[model samples]
Target: MAYFDQMGCKKRKRGERVFKFKTFGEQGHPVEFKGSFRQNVKSLLAFGNLGNSLCGGLASWSFQLEVHRNPPEHILLFVVEEPIEVSLNRHCKHCLHVGWGNHMICNKKYHFLVSSKETVATCFGYYEGNCNESYSGTAGKFNLVEFQGHVMHGVFHSNGFGHLLCINGVEMGSDLAGYQIMEFWDRLCTGLQARKVSLTDNSRKRSMDLRLLYGVAYSEPWFGRWGYKFGRGSFGVTQQMYRKAIQAIQNIPLCLLAQQFGNSSHDIPSMFSRYQTLSGHFLITLRDLLRFMLELKACLPSENGSIDTYHSGVLVDTTCRWSPKRVEMATRVIVEALKKAEFRWVSRQEVRDAARAYIGDTGLLDFVLKSLGNHVVGNYLVHRCLNPVTKVLEYCLEDISNGFFPSQEGSVTNDSELRTRYKITRAQLLKDMFCLYSHFLQEQKSMMNTGIFATTSLASRVILNSKYLIKEYCGKLPSLIQVGLGENSDVYCTIRVSHDGEVDEGRRKVIVPHECFMLRNNTTFNELMLEAEKSFKEIYFGLRNFSIKSIANLNAEGTDLVFKVVKVGGELVFEGSAGENGLNDEDVLEGFRRDSVVDCPCGAKYDDGERMVSCDVCEVWQHTWCVGIPDAAEIPSIYVCGRCEKDILEFPSLP
Candidate 1:
């Protein structure tokens, strides 16, 4: 029957076709059996020469092949057998649920037949789904293999929530679901609400907390899939969480908000509540703002963003929410109010720039004149009085000075009041202020040609120039007038003019016949002149109308005597004088003099009333008739003196 079957002879009708194949080989020969006719044909083709090789003393092996049904042409086959892998990928719609059982239960792996397909299903006491029918299987089809425990490949699927809870390449159990992540976010928000911490608080601890929450929500996991659904996006979830938190914060009451924000414990709630109650009535009037400015309670708006506590006290927050331009306008309003009160302060920055401009590279005076034109620099002087420094004694002086507040303008109504208030007269203040500025400007003026930027003014330049000229003139002024009086009411004094050339021994002191200059307590020029004239008459008897010229010589130009006097130790002394207009009680006079005197070696003072002659040899004066010249025309410009002629051998030597 086998040989006939091999020859394709059908003696009896068979329900199914069968094919058998055998192969022979040498030592260690391979034996193969075909289970179907297709496999038998493949086996026959694989083993060549099956005709005599089966019995040719070769290694022979025989096996039976059977097939109950025909095989499909191109059957689907698995690269691996038994299909133990469980993929929880979204494409496969599979998920894993882990369950733990008691230690006493033996570990096992079970295979289930579902719709004639095999899949791995392990049982503890729990399962993920409640639908038992979806996974139901007959007991006879279950196969138990050795089990290690929960060691298998499959990840959780979040069901309706998509793959949000799924982490690719990570086999997590389905029990850790997306709902748990959402619950975590909710709890955080609730905690924030219960604590009532202000979101705007810049405190260190609050800032740290916010940063920590933000960091945890946005930080990506090392091994998880970066998905977009549900709680998978760390950043997205964090944003949603903060949005809900902000909503919660907004729902808080205004009173509660203040209470939480205020860092004080005493009466803050009451005080804040009062403000809240009257918030509708709080009015910002011009007068109120002006008062605040005058009181120095607020400063001008600054360019650098900084909150003003003064404004905050007035229920105006200077936070970044307000525009800078609006804040600046408000600041200017306060400044205008300050100006109304006559309170001004120098800005060092502008002052420095003006100073630099005044002290330029070439001409310091020119620079100062230019700087005076600057609007900010022009009004620097305030009645020529500025406080240089402050001290205890200084405050006392300031108070005393304030009492003597001079009339702002026009004539003073009450002389007594003016005198009492201002112990120092206006003239004195003006003189002192001029001197101060003069010294200040001189010191600040740079002499070096270096063109470093500096600031100065025109008033300063005039002061400096005048100061130098006055100093130079003072050094050469004649010492005619005496200063300080003796205990006696009358004191003896000598007056003299400045000598431009050599002085004669006889004329070193101009003999004033008035030895006594009456030192009256009052400083009056009329009294002094009378006293001088009386002395002159005493010296030259019967001489009438003798005039006292301050700067007069027979040949030099003449000017009137305008005296400059200084009192020292209760004595009045004449320093020097420029002219009437140059007179200042505090100013030291300069370049003043009496008439120049001419004297000859002949022991006689020369005057225009006297007949005088000069010797060409010695340049000396002589009486025209006394020198043996009978007539004035007989005097010679080249005449030789007797003494000089004898020395020159022009006459006989005296024995």
Candidate 2:
């Protein structure tokens, strides 16, 4: 108190200082300091009724000097009579360890700060998807603490920073600074022994996923600027240019460039030579280098002529020297491109042709492409001189005015043509995939309505049943059916023939090959057998009479599933049961029929009566007046008893 007051500590108010100290004498007798107090004594209440640890060992004790001052003050002295004992429950004791301290499940640590003064207990535990654990073969140190039973109940964390500290299952002291937290802890354990409380690293408290940006391998300012605008803008020419640059290296379209530029250089074949020179290396023809230099000059549109034009510039270290300017950086990138080109040579004429192709495709000229041919000598000199370090790409452009890329080389190297072809191919493929995926999802949804769970494999059947996915096999079928010239041009039928037998008896399936389109379109059972003879000699030879009917289930044991294949109204369909293979329950196929224009039972060509009604039994349209029911509302829901009523009743009972 004296030290702080003498050293520029402002006097907030005037008050007397009181000290209450507890000490242990020689015989371990507790000695309390007698204090002069004329004020009333207030009794303190304990926190909770929870039992204390019976095996409680000596845990901790602390002594802190607290100061109090007020205006027109009266000095008062008060001391807590019953100190909070550091008690551990059975579970907490079991959770304690010697080196790493108390832990929860999976070797995770739980640190607790129990305050007797505030009557609050805070326990800090590790949460999943938090900080990555260090793998040093050692566990983290934590304090064994208890509130009611287990410390897992009142766990809470700040959503913003994931600052996890549980106070009775709620968060407390989260907004408090590290020093303030330490002071609060000290007040809570005044009688406890003093031990230094080490603060955990702030990185561990963060909820943000920052691992992707943990290193400093890239330059700060450039990376920051680029990262800020990484995926913000629209899909534009910049993306196309970047794509071209990548593709040039990946697809190696330089052969096309060599062919286009071959006429510009003498001994063009020699320019592409990979033969080692006299100095134990392949000699890069100076003329070939000149041709590439001219091509870059003709294609790239670098805005600046020299480094002197740059007001704000970066010092770029080339192999030969250090230079500063956006223009120089642009040249350095071109040099990198040439090195990657791997001795593939192109002529100046080829460069111009490539530029034309690029201008036609993108419909605009980039900075580098604009700069090319604008200042040929300047570009030539820069390309010849510029050589950069490996990490030159790490630098970012502070301003876009610095330069443009000679991306016209992309067109020259056949990159643009290839890209267009790829896009068309990709678009068609994408449309097909969308159709297939949509079909699968629709099938799944349909099956779900029928209380059937459609798995991934079953959903794929929708694609299999379609003609498009299996076009390679299905496309040739129509031609084979039309010609019937080839030996294998036949329709194959897999018929599962069932028989009356025991429950364990399986159905027998036979594959019968018939002549193409024989069982389709207006062909009767007798005609099918006669046509089947052309394909199957043994089964169909001289076969005459046969019976064909739609298969239906009537709890019969020996019912054979028959499918009548037909081309009804131009679509190949099976006129049979809805539950047939590859057909949905809703797909109940019907045969093609001709509707006869017959007069109604009322003896009219068309029903024109106002109160018209139709007989439900015979589907005969009749005037309500003729049926003795003049009102349309008087038409019974179960309309019957018309002229064909007796016949309708006996039709179902017919043998």
Candidate 3:
């Protein structure tokens, strides 16, 4: 009988089948059959031929098979490709022999043979006999082989098309199932170097390319599948993994194009240029800020020396203290000197010398000191007189020199109480004397150049101008007319012409002798003028005292004289005398009484019979009678009366 298979093909071929039979004998010898021949022997011979092919020729086939008494109710065929083969060797009697291809043989009887495709070497089925010693009688039909260090199992199957094997028994249709098998084979063949396989050696590489092409071709379905697995709802499960994968891909090198040719020098120059530009701009801005701060410091009011507790105390109780304006002026002078030395075009040493000379000149120093008691700059004024050299002693010398003095418009009330409280230093008094001499010279010059005066007026103007210039430039003035004057008194004189170029009738006249007296007076005039000039030089350069007696004896014959005397207390007493004889006691006494009534020493008021005593240090006045002193035979030349003497001793000198 012939059977029909599922593909509509006859399972047997008539008259073409052959059969061969064999029987086992002792020692595995072939034995002839004892049964008689049947009429259907060709069918039996065909079955025997099929069985022989299954046992021997099937060893080279890439398929696994199993024979059972009953066929399986359901059959599933799988296809696989195998690159390596395993077979049993029949040369050994007691042992199963294994070799590649058809060289394998076995001693024990086996009912089935298993084979697999070169690509699909893994298979699974049931076996009835142990064909090889290592194969159990009931083993699963599969080929197990070791390649490198990894073990690979293969299985084969028969489908309608042909026999196929499953590598590692993995289903080929499953996702990544093909990759799994190829990776296993790859690991076995190459070990770690398998990852470096190129297209030449790796069929998997071609497969991977085909898969990628297919994925792109069916992008919709693949993307749909991917989205279903890793959509927004599923992102929590794979976000970190996906991000890592992207980062790895980005870090991987795609080509070596950049290594061969890359331009970085172009960027380097630009980067450095930008950095230098920004750095230079920053430095310039910093310099400008420093300059601005320095200029600001210049504009602020500053003081010399740090403020100490004493300075703070004086500032707080300013009414009895020297005004801050004086201190500020001193500070300005110091600061200006420093600035000139530092910034002026002139040499520093030259600037320093000029500053010192300007400050040291008695006339200029006196003007600055006097301006301390008046507003000479800005909104501030010095309301109290300060001793520039002593620093501590101050005075309110408010007796304004009214007749022939440097004048400004404003008047300040004399603070008698303050004057009594403060005393001027000797240096300050000398400075004031120098300033006054300059003022007198200025007045005499104005008088002489007016030219409205006659011979006498001209003479007087010339005399006054000469005397004042001598005193100012050489630093002293002399007195010619004196019968009696205080020990500390020095006379300064200024003679002015009448507006009509004549001696005014209303003015007091000086008596003069006729004829011979005039000649003698001319001689006296020459001698006294010379002596006055000499005395100026002695006082200025030698620092000597200009005595009233020495100046009075300059002329022996009669001469007209006008005297303005500064008593020890800085008071001015004026007297005029034109004389053939020297001033009589009565004239001297009368002039003294008139000037002395208002405290001839300091222009301070005196109580009845309160004779003023003069300070030898500053030549200023205090009341002798009020100070509890009896009259002395003569006022001591070096006597600073008690109060001023005490003040001088107490006040410290400037550094």
Q: Point out the worst 10-residue segment of candidate 2 by lDDT.
A: 36-45
CA lDDT, every prediction? Answer: 0.25, 0.25, 0.25
- Write the number of the candidate with greater lDDT, choosing between 2 and 3: 3
- What is the Cα-based TM-score of model 2? 0.16
Question: TM-score for every candidate vs. truth?
Answer: 0.13, 0.16, 0.12
Candidate 2 residue 625 C-alpha distance from true site, Å? 73
Give lDDT for model 3: 0.25
Instruction: Write model 1 residue lDDT over 534-576, tens digit each, in one string.
Output: 4443332111233333422112222222223323322222212
TM-score of 1: 0.13
Q: Per-residue lDDT of 1-655 in model 2, one digit per residue for the tens?
A: 2222332123213342322211211111121111101000110111111211211221222122233243121111112121112222211111111111111111012132323222222211221122254422112232224333221111101000011132221223232333333333332222111111111111211221111111111111111221211111011113233233222222323243344335654333322321110011111332222223223233333433211111111222364232334443443343334334443433333333444542332212233323332122111211211125432111111111112212223211224443332222223323422332242222346534332224322322322211100001111122213322333122332122222211112211111211133233334544433333322222221111212222222221222211233222122211121122322111111110123122344344332213455666556555565567755457878676455777766676656
Which ranges of candidate 1 are over 4 A from the true structure? 1-571, 574-610, 650-655
Provide the lDDT at 648 for model 3.
Answer: 75
Evaluate model 2: give its lDDT: 0.25
